[model samples]
Target: MAEPILKWAGGKRQLLDELYARFPASYGRYHEPFVGGGALFFDLEPADAAINDANPRLIGFYERVRDEPEALIERLEAFDDPDADPDPSLPYHEETARGRDVESYYYQQRARFNRRPYEGAFDPLEEAALLLYLNRTCYNGLYRENADGGFNVPAGRYANPDWVQRDRIRRASDVLAEAAIRNDDFAYVLDAADPGDLVYFDPPYEPMSATASFNEYSADGFDREDQRRLLDVASELDEAGVRVVLSNSGVMYEPYADAGFRVETEDATRAINSDPDSRDAVDEIVATNVPPEDRGSAGQRELSGF
Candidate 1:
């Protein structure tokens, strides 16, 4: 089954075509070092692929979907009725808004999320439902943490945001079932790559402009050192004949170019910060190891069955 198309923050659904255009006609296997949303993974539909993330909960959700898709689907489908009332019984809003002692509050919500019955707590079918819920309903969809390593984002503005994409989740699970899911630091997956493997890196953007940064995807911040390490990995992969595509804030391309990667820039608009004022245009870059000759000359390229 084809992977379901999902709407997720940092998802590359919009750039799938553009990224695919740069991929070679064929590759031995696919690898994603930081598979945040799995947008590119599902889009490419590689027969054999390795998808890894540092977030254990996120990866566990993916594994659950793959192993018990029916249960997950049933949980998500319960939210489908248009007239269903939002679960106001929960104190997620009040607890999240009073952010003074946010760590406790955030974990309380996480505990609530983890403890609820399959129907009330979380829907198994829509693996994305919990992700989307925490993303939209939580502080800023900004997966952040306090000094103690607890999620600390405040509640968001969406009163009853739609949290389930039943069919899409099913599809995404289908795709995930065939791929290997790993929960580890990015290096472990990158090191596992073989010659001709394709790796796509979507690390947190290094905030360039005053208003254009969101480097706090996890409690452990991805700093400049991490960025440099990623570049080094890309270089090592290139030397090993592995194709690498990296997306990041456009400001870092000069360093990447210095590392011998061919950099291509594009303008991208995203709604990131919870504030409406923060949702504006931004420039992003796609640095690649694929040879220029192999890239599509025109529109987005389709690389799945190539």
Candidate 2:
């Protein structure tokens, strides 16, 4: 299966099996309203899919990957090209003892990305490439934006990171060829979805505690109001005969349960945790309108005899 192009903070890479089991056996169209990283979407690779995200630049990156894979790969190659004379503008964090000014190079690229020209010189293609590079090399591979919608992530210290994922990008492009990319609110799925289709809602998770909030993948943090609004949307989709499946933090237990859906908690991997020892697994709530009988046990099949 093709991998996700970006390393999104709350990405659903670890929940793939749980998600697939609960998915409708058959559906007309696939919709991911909050398509961050889209690990499951890449795994499923539905032919007629519509994926949207609040991050306009992320959406643009997907569009670029789908339409201009060659161009994207070319730029990535330029970023990874060690043989070529290093451009004074772009930064390459060298791992060897002959170390370059790592922080200086990374922040410089970050500034260039934030101050990208809209029309004349620096094109959208370059901007998209920079986004990929930044996400790959940034601290913990986390894509966190500042209040001004600027990309404000520090550089990661890696010996030799796969900064240029040429094959991965090519594979992702092939998969996204079938998907319609969008840059809009998650509510856009309501109008785009039809009966017999499927919509998976993986919104910014409800924080477990006031101090534990990590929903700032974008500038505008997802609040409790947004969470409630999403639940309403899910209910509307359920009523319209569209299959609805959602994943959120454990704090959403009451709300999702009250909405008359099958709610189950599964241990999922959290890739970006400050406490290194605490990065194993956390209980995440998975609520879906897919009938209990229809949904299979992802874990049961793994047993030698079941």
Best by lDDT: 2
Question: Mind giving the per-residue lDDT tens digits that candidate 2 earns over 176-240?
Answer: 99789999888888888999888999998887778878887888888989998999999999998
How many residue pairs clash (N, CA or C atoms closer than 3 angstroms) in each of the candidate models, in the order given? 6, 0
| Candidate 2 error regions (>4 Å) | 80-86, 89-103, 116-122, 295-306
Give, for candidate 1, the lowest lDDT window spanning 10 residues.
Answer: 97-106
lDDT of each: 0.65, 0.78
lDDT: worst 10-residue window of model 2:
297-306
How much does each candidate deviate from the true structure in C-alpha RMSD? Answer: 5.9, 5.5
**Alpha-carbon RMSD, candidate 2:** 5.5
**Model 1's lDDT to the true fold?**
0.65
How far does residue 53 in candidate 1 sit from its true spot (Å)?
Answer: 0.9
